[model samples]
Target: MTTQNLLVELFVEELPPKALKKLGEAFAGALADQLRAQGLASEDSLVTAYASPRRLAAHVSHVWLKAADKAVQQKLMPVSVGLNTEGQATPALLKKLAALGADVSDPAAAVAALKRAPDGKAEALFYDSLVTGATLDTGLQKALDEAIRLLPIPKLMSYQLESDCELPGWSSVHFVRPAHGLVALHGSTVVPLKALGLTAGRSTQGHRFEAAVSPVVIEHADHYAETLARDGAVIAGFEARRAEIVSQLAEAAARLGGGVRAIEDEALLDEVTALVERPNVLVCEFEPQFLEVPQECLILTMKANQKYFPLLDAQGRLTHRFLVVSNIRPEDASAVVGGNERVVRPRLADAKFFFDQDRKKTLASRVEGLSRVVYHNKLGSQGERVERVRAIARAIAQPLGGEALAQAADTAAQLAKSDLLTDMVGEFPELQGIMGGYYARHDGLSEDIAFAIEDHYRPRFAGDALPRSAAGVVVALADKLETLVGMFGIGNLPSGDKDPFALRRHALGVIRMLIEKDLPLELDGLLAGAWPVFGERVVDAHTALADFIYDRLAGALREQGYSAQEVDAVLALRPQRLGQVARLLAAVRAFAALPESPALAAANKRIANILRKAGEVDPHVNPQLLQEPAEQNLYQAMQRFVPEANAQFEAGDYTASLQTLAALRGAVDAFFDDVMVNAEQLDLRLNRQGLLKSLHEAMNRVADLSRLAA
Candidate 1:
């Protein structure tokens, strides 16, 4: 099993910058995984993924030139079927032997050599053979094909390449981009293969304009990255290139001498890194007058449209100076700096024009235009959706805040979607809520209303921040609830990771807000309020929606480090106040750690099963019916501690409440050990069932202890 590090590179036109990181990782991972599965690479083989604007590559350490030979025993037909009663080979066995490349001239001899093994209920004949190892050339070809097939390509480009054959022809090829070359090396020797109409070679093209030498030759499998860097003028690794860009941005910003720093956006940084090979961070500036526009608007245009990093000052305001990642670094870099500055000026001017034009028509005036904008074909227009959201917002606001907050929320919800009609938002749909906030302020609205308008879409994704203002929280809740209830009601529920409307995200957002904000709002009541807003347009499926939200909440809690049993215990009750779920989970954890938790949890499970079997058992206990000592002792324990636990529960001390029950573990064990819950005497049986019912209720006030049962 002689081994050498392997390197494979696919050179193409510039990849989709945003998708490059994922594509590169998928390519390398799929290649390594397939190789390992085929026994061409060991489990500990290290894989280094390389991705740049023009290429995706991988360097796998300790890959075998040929997979180890394996001994295999393949099952044939049953012994009875393979051999006749005379112990001679039958026609079926002779045919099978021929197919297996065994000599069938002597059928009896062939049948005698076959081994017998039990397969299911019958003894079956088996063929024992050794499978030859796969050569590196063949295995690498299969791996290369598999890796290309598995790339997470954002989009595919279909193109034709000019054939180099004597017979003139054009070959059609489809890939993430038009792949010009491929490099596959095993210790400096090119692995003979073909992919995407190109033959494997040791040479690959580098940065289109900055390569020190054209068609840089990779000297060895281990030297692929270094050779490309020195001669091809490319940084081959995605993370390495990103880190370099970060360092350059910092250094370039420091030279400006204003306590300025590049805005921290890892996604933006990655995209910029993928857009350049040899990144030359240059400080470029625009006219300071453009600062009058919203910094968010300017910064977004710069990053999204131009792929530039906007610098921020100490005050957290946008600075005129920004950093550009130039692919080529020429002496006296003034031309590159000037070109980027000149290109950004027009983009900034467009954003400024949109901002100024958008402000001309106050958000209040844009309300009527929203009716023409469709939110959903079945849910009606944006105007109707706004009304539904406004209604839900006001209903939510009454409990979150007083009439003042209600008014603010109503205003914000009504105008939140109006920005869709604005030029600025139309140009950049990502700035929908953002531009609305600006317009609200321009209309001389209160700060609370403006902030609420912007923050209503808070927590757009996982781990995103929630709304800042009370009014914003109310509106955000309303908006999310409206979507959930409406979508669920319409029977357009999410199915298997296909949430076209991002309903999962909305559900998680609601859960995060309720749990993190510790809002006093009940989940049922909120759904009840949001449903009527849809009026006759939707069915009453709020129960299903509640279940959906709770499911999301349970998963989120588990992700936050709670065990499945802990989550199940707390969520079993369907506690109306979602804010209390965290406390319930904490209480469950503390109770689980108790020394007596296992016994108590098991007892609780038994009690639940018994109760479920005994239909409609009253919890009212008659002390005189407790003839057994174990029952009497458990009754006395309950009488003493049930009140204490209840009191703690009422006082919101859930941990204390669950902890007080730990003292009753011994009595519970004794009762279950000695007492007959289903005695022959009806009175005794009913009374005993009643006693267990009382115990069940008290133990499960915070969470269903039975669910924690093993």
Candidate 2:
């Protein structure tokens, strides 16, 4: 029953910075999960994960030294197989008992003790026993092995361990990195286990150069982080190290004193945190001439290539000075700052050179080079894709703004991918559309056209801003639709988590543009226009592509706080004008919350069923056939309310339209309750069906209210 806090650490060579956070979380989560599954750790146990550039560790509280004993019931063979006709134990039963490590001295007595339970049509014999709990040593070993096997390693490093760590011969081991040490502590005692050719010990190596002690001694399980920080001079926890770096970056940026701040990028911060153990943010600078080149180029080079955070001024302009997260905090610190500055100058110069050289050739001149660059083997060259995109863009633009916008969109789409041929775009592919815009401006093109080229790739990810100009909107929509239709046409749709082409993102981009821009374009018309651009290269994937877009839209609406029922009610119609979907959903939600919503929703569901079963009945209510008082009352209600609701619907007042129908709830409910829909007379039955059909049509204008029924 004794329990103790446990600590585990795997020290290794530097890990891939981008993947370190995931690796750390997965390692800690898998280890703790395995321990809990084995009953060695309780649900109340707390797990703290620590990860640095060189280590991944987990400290778990209240881990028992041994798991609790578990009761197990195992079904044996049928009674007929285990016992003879005379109710005596058979040889097979004795063999089975012997195999189970049970006493088989008297088979009859053993069989008599077995429980009888009915399994299907036959009675079966069952054996129950207490399973001894696993010892901590064995459980920890299994958990460690599983955790290591499950680490989200970006790439595995294979190496031979030192002879002393394993056998005398060169023993090959593959891991995220070559393991230098493994520390496993249960309280103050060392837990006997081995991983990656290293035995468990209290000593683990810390910061390579700044450690107070080369081999940090973790005195106890709970003392891991504090001890490492004090003796090893390393911030062992990933979040702790990141917070320290962020604080240091802010402090350093403040010293510059011109409303300057380090550029904020979570991914960049995480990567930099994973690159250093003891972060010491120091100020560094480059020549102001480098700033003359596009700030994006300088920023990208500094952050992506050098892992530096560029300081930005009050006007959002990149400052010459940047912050570097140095691993060692030397007293003077001059050498570290100078070294980083020197290292970064060449990277900046390269970017500037690429930018300058790229400007010499206009985007128009480079358009021909895209033919040499293949976009996709099956989809043809970038040149061909550009032509297709231009065709789609022009088609989209004509309806929105006549020939002026169409020409602008066509011009932008033609030059959008032309930047791919530029040296700057080749050096930094992230700046493709951006450099295209810059070069378009340099070519003396109109600002609108240049902006359209630049903004064509807007809203690349979720929550990103859409294109600002009419031309940009047209080009952006065309670009995304082409990717969606082309990819879906080839049957390369996203399955589960595997979307190589990012078709889901493209679909979402199209949906956002249509809905957010409130562009009068219909989804079916958009797809019909995009499909022909591919000609025979693509199959008729219009229907499939539209469905995929709707699926993404449904998910997006649900994420925006609509319940599944509410979203289903609205999206069930597959509304063509996605711009109105938000309005439709709002109306549906408003209608569902009303006092009369439940009754009306149920009646609408009943009416739908009745109409479906009636098989294509006209909604024209023949008043002469309305004999019952309930049917006649419903007829009068429809005549009085239907036209007003239709007027509200035509005026774009969906909420008012749906709310207006709530008045007929009484008549609708009474009609369903009192009238016989299937009367003996054919004319009466048809009339009743027609009245219900009319009600169904009016109730579902905004959404399929029946889908909201419980």
Candidate 3:
């Protein structure tokens, strides 16, 4: 067998910039996987993917010209069914051999060649055959077809190509983009194949306008990337081009020498990389007066609308100058720079105008407008939702900080959704809460209230920060709770991956605030408080929403490196105060490490089963009914250790509480080993069950130790 590097390329119109990275990876991975599955490539083969705005290509090393032959063993029918007792081949056996392309001319010889093996209770005859290897041409064709079929195209396009035959007609072809050329090479030889109405060739177009040659010609499979780069003026590899863009951006920023750097956004970087072939970083600037608006507005417009990276000072303030990644490198770059600057001025002016006009009416005045904005058909308008949040926030703050905190929370909640009616926020929905804060300050509201109004939507996504002030925390919790309770009440629960309302995110947000903020709030109590705000619009879904929150908490804990067993042990108790869950988990982990843990866990599990079967056994054990020595000793041990564990638990030392309870492992194990929990006498049985019941409660105060049982 001979091996050589292989290369394949598809030249087409521009692909979707956002999907190009994933599309390139999927194509190369699928192609290499198919080759290996067909035995045309080994496990040690190196696969390199190349993607640009107009092309997708792959280079694979150590691909075989023809796979090696393999021996295959196939099970035939049972010996009794294939052959008769007369030691002669039946018609069925001969027909099976013929279908397998075996030598059926000599039936006796064919029967002798079959091997008998025991399959279960019966013996079956097996046939052995040598499977021929697949040639590179056929293997590559199959691989190419599979790769194209497996592309994760966001959408497909249909186009027509002129008929190549004598008939004057056109044929419709569907693909991600219109395919213009296809190239497949093995070493220096072109591999013949056809895909998307295009034949394999050695030439592919490169950068649209800057290519040194008309169509870059790849002479060998190993020289594809180098040839394309040198003659086509394009960087073929996606990661390589992205890295070049990053380096150029840094070098250009360093030249300004003001401790200025480009805003870091990986998604913007990747999208920009996909849109260009040869990246040429250029410095562009808008008027400094545009900075009068919020830096967020300017940055969002530049990155989201213009695909530019706005420079920021060391203190994270936006500067007037920005960087643009142009696809072409012109000798006189002044035109490109000036053109981008001119294009961005209008966008900035629009944002400024919206911001300026939005401040004319205070947030209080806009509160009336939210009544016309629909939030959910079943949940009424944003105005109605605002009242629900205010009620919930007041209930939450009354217990945490008394009347002052309640007043602040109420004020913030009232104005929170008011910004949804503002022109600035109406134009950019991402800035709803932020614009509310700015306008609140302009309305002469206190910093605490303004911050709360802005920070009420904290932790909008995973790893996002929580509210800064106490009032902000209260308002954030209330807002998320109202949404969860209302949605779950109305039966709009998330199913599978279709979370249109992002209910899961809202649940996690509530859990994060409750636990991370260490608010002295109980989960059930919060749900109860939120339930009445919706009145009759929603049904009783308190239980369902609480379960949803706990499920999200368990998943988050596991993601933070807690094992499934550990999470299950602690969450099994449904601890209402989520702030204590982390401590409970720590205690469970500490208890699990004890030398006596396994035996105690097993004993605890046994006791649970015994008590469950006993049905409502009281925890009161009569000292006189303790006949067995083991039972009496266990009772005495509980008297000494149970109080100490209870005291530690009351003091919030969960780890100490669990460890103190671990002292009774010896007595617990002895009792389970020596005494019968269900005795023949009714009084004796109940007394023993009571003792075990008492022990169960003490052991599980922190976490259910039985879950730690192997």
Candidate 4:
């Protein structure tokens, strides 16, 4: 048991944050695969990888000093495609394998040697059988080199433009950015590998601004991280980057009075990481005049245009002051502060002018303008959509109680896109929905109406929130439903993975809102009623696109802590009420853990098997054809249970209905046990099948129990 480790580092100019993160992960995976492929990674040692904007590194411990034994399996697809039962290569297999350069001759051909992987006998067969063998079993160093070569970098380019070559200068290797150098060490052992256009060395570069390209030598594999940090670069991984941002923002904001609060800017943080090797806090203030603009305008101008953070007062009011994270310490910081402030003034001024001008027109006045702003060619004008929304929202809202949420919803839906007519919102398209909400409130519309306008687009993404207010929920559902109906009407149904219109998101949005509010509206009928509104534009639901909405629900239920099977069970009952489906899923999980389901499943299976065998026949049984007492008793039990089960199902008590069916399981088991279902007499068999068919019919009214996998 000897000990050894290999460390490799790549130093490059800053790469884009997303590309860096992706490449980091991909490189790490590729490195592990390379190690295992070469037997350098085993149960005995570990292989790990890490990446940041400036560097990517991988470490393998107990790495074999010598290359491991290798046996390459090349394809012989054509030759093996129609191979015989005996160990012989088809002429095609021989031809293909020969073209593939496989040594198929002498003792045995490649296809001839291909055998059904013997059970537990050979590891190679299992590895080789994978789709495309999608695994590497080559030399460790070679595999690492190959993986780097194959890594996908967005916007890849050659650095050098000349030498009569259109081919760009690769990092002298394939990478999104230049690979300045490589550091390769083996537990302080230098594993020379420069031939791959990479150096085997113990040294690495420091911060691009302060430390420049100065290389610091590392003595050991574990010290690689610590040494980089000590060199004033927070390369301890992404956590270092995140921690720096939080602390710097807090410290920078504290000097002004309140701590800096993070804006809704996941994308900005990523870009910042790529732009800096070291992070330090910097705060600057602007003229108070900018604060008069909409907070979104103020915030967006800084984050999107200047990459700055707009400050907030203790009361959560936007202040003119802002923060910026910098890569270098400023001697006279005012230079940096003044530079950013100067750039933001023009952008903020444009926002203010738009806001002032937009307030001149009332939301009602802009209603006619929405007709020109087409929602979807199939969905009709936004004005027409507002009408449908008004109708749908009114029907859905009045029932939510004390909230007057419905009126608020109708008001909001009418004003939802009215901001599009505004000059400011036109320039800042991202502010479309938010500006509408702001304008409604500014124009003295109720808070509920304003909030509904804003929150209608809530939970826009998978994990996003659903509207909590009744009015918001109604409008959100109405807005989504109209879009769905209009899309379906015009033959724009999404097929396979293509959903250019985001109909899937709209469907999920409606379902999530209805479920959240416990609205008891029937979705199928709601969709059908909107037919007149959609007219010839109604798209058919023949594709899986309709069920795809349910798939979204199933996913949402899982996020709420229900297992996929439990969700499936609830949906199997065809429960249209999402809230009930949620409760039903909980019940199914509880019942599944009980001692009764297997017995019930078995009994349910018997009923299904009988019905399946009977195949599309009438459920009616001749009373005279039942020769056995058990058959009569089972039939009697099911007949008695049907009324209760039907009521439970109608009330969405799926579990209770399932329980009602379960109660008949004992009678069902007895009937099948005590009687020969395939009776010798033809009429008797029909009678028995009819009895089972009736049992199935009772169970299915509650759920499509036949679809339930045992």
Candidate 5:
């Protein structure tokens, strides 16, 4: 077998750097898939990708030459027809010959040719074959042709050339940018590649800026990447712009007085990657006064205006200077620094204005302004949303200590959206909740409530943080409920990856508040109560959003490494009690690792098994219904155990709960060992089931202990 290297390079007009990065991996994976589908990829086949803003390329090495030959046979359809009474060929049957493009007079030969002569190859000699040409090497052109068809380059266009070669439109792949051309070659020789109608070649180009226009002539496909690398391109295969930015940032930070503190900004990195060819860092300073205007606003300015990485001091505090990454190096360096600083000035100045104006207006006064601002096109305005949230806060407050929590939540919600209308948040929209916290404090809200104002947006990203205080948790839940309800009312819930309303975030936030904050607020009741105040105009707003937030609970738990099976088991019993599910999950996880805990798990498993058969159990399972001695014994044991299991679960002492629940194993096992559930007497069977139900019911109060896996 001859070893061969295959290379295909798509040279296009400047491509979006971020797009190129993702597209690169997609290209490689797609090509490998096409090879498998075509029966070409083999044991040694592997695909590698390389991308730059101007081009995306992939190389397939040691790929199988072509689909292996297989013996072929075709089955002929059986035809049976008869004439009326006389058993002769009828006119209808005779006329069918013409429809089949055959004549009755000459059909014998055609029929005979399709007949199988034997069970094996003896049959092949008899049947005529419809053969497709096969080659040893799959080569490169068709692979590229498949890539072009499946690549799905966003904002794609068509590239038509008058080489007089014929191909279908879908196969004649074009892109958003002009493809300077594609070079498809196997082992440096032009392979017989055809689909998009181009054969393999030995030539490629270097970096658009770094290398000369003269193509980097290649000797072999194996050397294609190295050739380009020698021409000042690193083609190990990823986004060059991002790689360069990270590399240059690290180098630059090491040279600075301290490390370049990385501020979290993936979105900014994506946007800026497209704006550069090569990334270089330049440290620039802003006025110290700008730091006072909220680090969030200043950082956003640094990222938005300058595409810079913000720096942090030794104390993890935002410094006055930021590191701006430019695509091209400047000769007069000071000019670039001045230009970025000038551009960011307006953004920071706007922050200062929002702070001052908001300071002048009491946080309490902002409540009235909320009513004036529209919350949704159909769900009234900010004023209406505040009203709904105030109601929700009260609904949730009862579990969190009704009146005090309610007041705090109501105050926070009243002032929450005020910052949205302020100059700073309007300029830096991400500062909406942050500005609210600032004004809430100035207006005399207690520290807890003011922090709640800011923290309502807590954990904007997964694993960020849960609301820190009871008030903050309530308001966060209220805010998320409003967003989910408002958006869902308008039919804007997340479907797959298309969450236009950020409903996933709202739901995750709600779940975080429920579990981490341990708010015992019921989702359905809260939404139902808030609907009259907020959901009157929206369609199916109550249940729709309740179910949506519930779904997010599963997702949040899954992210923490919970199994789908475990989630299903817990959710099956108490779907809405997200905090309860979390608590039970901990107990089960701890119990599983305990060597002595299996007997307890076995007992719970027996309880769950019995509960499943005795379906639709009442929570008020009658202990008095117990007729058997075992039934009476189990009821007393469960009565004694419920509080302890509930206490362990409540305190998050899962290990303790496992011990407490396991303690009931002896009584549970004894009851099952000695008892019969479906006795001949009706009252006794129901009583036995009621006894088992009591055990299941008590354990489920903290968790469906029966749901615990052995």
Candidate 6:
């Protein structure tokens, strides 16, 4: 068998910039996977993916010209059914052999060739044959077809291909884009195949305008990338082009020499990389007076609208100059720079206009406008949602920080959604909470209130920061709680991977604040407080919503490196104060490490089963009813250790509490080994059950020890 490196490329119209990276990876991965599955490529084959604005390609090394032949054995039928008692093949056996393309000309010879093997209780006849392997041409065709079928194309386009015949007609073809050419080479030979109405060739177009050659010619499979770069004026690999863009951006920023750097956003970088073939970083600038608007507005406009990188100074203030990644490298470059600067001026001016007009009316004035803005069809207007949040925030703050904090929280919550009516926020919804803070400050509100209004939407996504002030924390909690409860109450719970309202994120935010802030409020109490705010708009879904929050918490804890068993044990108790969950998990981990942990856990499981079966056994045990020596010893051990464990638990030293309880493992094991929990006498059985129940309660103060049982 001969092996050679292979290269394949698809030349098409511009691809969607956001999906280019994943498209390239999926294309190459599926191609190589299909080849390996067909045995035309080995496991150690190196696969390199190339993607540009107009092309997707892959180079795979160590691909076989023809896979090696394999010996295969297949079951035919049971021996009793395939052969007669005369040791001759039956008509059914001959027919099966004929269908398998076996030598059926001589029935006796065919019968002799069959092997008998035991399959379960019966012996079966097996056929042995040599299966010919796939050739590169056929294998590559299948791989190409599969790769294209498996592409994660965001959307498909339908176009017509001109007919090759004399008849004037066209054929419709559907693909991500109107593909014009395909290059497939095994070593130096072009693999004969056709896809998307184009025959495989050794040449492809590159860098729509700047290519040194009209059509870049790939001389060999190994030379695809090098030849493309030298003749086509394009960087074929996605990561290579992205890295070049990064390096050029850094160099251009260094030339400014004020400790200035481009704002770091990976998504923007990737999208920009996908939009260009040969990246040439150019310095562009806008009027410095545009700086009057918030830097966030300028940054968002540049990155989101113009795809430009806004430079920031040492103090993290936006500079007048920005960097642009141009596809063409012109010598003078002044025209490119001027054109980009001119294009961004109107966008900046619009943001400034919206900012100026928005400040004329204070956030308090805009509060009335939110009544007209619909939040949810079932939940009424934003005005109604604002009142609910205010109520919840006040309830949360009253217990956490007394009356002053409650007043601050109420004020912040009242103005929080008011910005949704502002022109600036209306134009850029991402800046809803952000614009509120600016307008609040402009209205002569205190910094505390302004910051709270802004930070109320904190932790909008995973890894995002929480609120900075106590008032902000209250408002954020209230806002997320209102969403969770209201949505869950309306039976809009997240199903499968669908969470249109981001209910899962809201639940996680609530959990993070409760635990990370270590707020003294109970989880159930917070949910209860939020329910009444909705009044009759929502049904009683409190239990379901709490379960949802706890589930999110358990997942989060597991992601933070806690084992499933540890999370299960701690969460099993439904600890209302989520702040203590981390400590409970830590205690469980510590308890699980004890040498006596297994026996105690097993005994705890046994005791749980007994108590459950006993049905409502009291924890109180009359000392006189303790007849067994083991039972009396266990009671004495509990008297010494249970109080100490209870004291440690009360002090929030969960690890110490669990460790203290570990001291009774010996007595617990002895009691389970010697005494019967369900005795013949009713009094004795109830007393034994009561003793076990008391032990169960003490052991489970930190976490359910039974869950730790292996």
Residue by residue across 1-710, what tens digits does model 6's lDDT show?
A: 67899999999999999999999999999999999998999999999999999999999999998988889999999999999999899999999999999999999999999999999999999999999999999989999999999999999999999876688899898899999999999999999988998999998987888899978999899998888889999999999999999999999999999899999999999999999999999999999999999999999999999999999999999999999999998888999999998999999999999999999999998888889989998899999999999999999999889999999999999999998888888789999889999999999999999999999988899999999999999999999999998898899888899999999999898999988999888988988888888878999899999899899998999999999999999999999998888888989999899998999889889888888887888899999999999999999999999999999999999999988988898898888789988899999988988898999999998888889898
Per-residue lDDT of model 3, residues 1-710, tens digit only: 67899999999999999999999999999999999998999999999999999999999999988988889899989999889998778899999989999998998999999999999999999999998988899999999999999999999999999888799999999999999999999999999989998999999997889999978999999999899899999999999999999999999999998899999999999999999999999999999999999998889889999999999998999999999999999999999998998999999999999999999999999888888989999999999999999999999999999999999999999999998888888788899899899999999999999999999998899999999999999999999999999999999999999999888998899899989988899999999999999999999898889889889999999999999989999999999999999999999998899898999988888888888787888899899999999999999999999999999999999999989988898898888789988899999998998899999999898988889899
The CA lDDT at 467 in model 1 is 94
> What RMSD, rounded to one decimal, does every model reach?
1.9, 2.0, 1.2, 6.3, 6.3, 1.2
All candidates' TM-scores?
0.96, 0.96, 0.98, 0.80, 0.77, 0.98
User: What tens digits encode model 5's per-residue C-alpha lDDT throughout 1-710?
Assistant: 46466776776677765576677777777776766565566646877776766666777776555556654554332233323355344455446434544456754444444443444433322233533434534424455667767775677767774564364343454565766656666666666554443444556666655564457766776876677667634343455556777776666666766654666577777666665655667877778987877787777777766667888776678988777877556577898888888877776787677677768877676677777776667778878777787777777876677687788788777777777777777777878788788777778778998788898888788778777788888888788877777777777767778877688887777777677655566666666766665535777666566666666776767888997756655666655556667667766666656655566556767767776887776545565676667667767877787788778767867658666766676777777788887788877777676666666655655445445454
Residue 505, model 1: Cα distance from true site in angstroms: 1.7
lDDT of 2 by residue, 590-617 (tens): 9998999999988888888877787898
Give lDDT tens digits, candidate 1, residues 416-512.
9999999998899999898999889889998888899999998999878999999889899999998999999899999997999999999998988
Clashing pairs in 5: 65-137, 65-138, 157-175, 184-200, 370-383, 371-383, 373-382, 374-381, 375-381, 375-382
The 10-residue segment with the lowest total lDDT in model 5: 75-84
Candidate 1 whole-model C-alpha lDDT, 0 to 1 = 0.91
Better of 1 and 6 by lDDT: 6
* Model 3 pairs in collision: none
lDDT of 4: 0.70
Worst 10 residues of 6 by lDDT: 162-171
Q: lDDT value for candidate 6?
A: 0.93
lDDT of 4 by residue, 1-710 (tens): 35567677777777777677667767766766776665666665665666777888777677665544555543333322435557466666566556555576742545445644433433212112322222222354576686677677778755642222466553333457766677777677776655235556788877766663466778897787788777635554655675678777877677666554645476787777655667776777788876777798778767877787777877777887778877776678778777777877888888888888888888778988988887766567788878887877776666665346666777788888788888877888878778888888788988878888888777688878887666777788877877776676676777899988788888878787768767777666566655565555565652344466677787777888876666665676556666666666655665566666677666776677766766775788888777688988887887788888889877867678777767776777788679998788888888787777777777765445433446
- Report lDDT (CA) for all predictions: 0.91, 0.90, 0.93, 0.70, 0.67, 0.93
lDDT of 1 at 494: 94
Candidate 3 achieves a global lDDT of: 0.93
Off by over 4 Å in 3: none
Model 3 compared with the native: what TM-score? 0.98
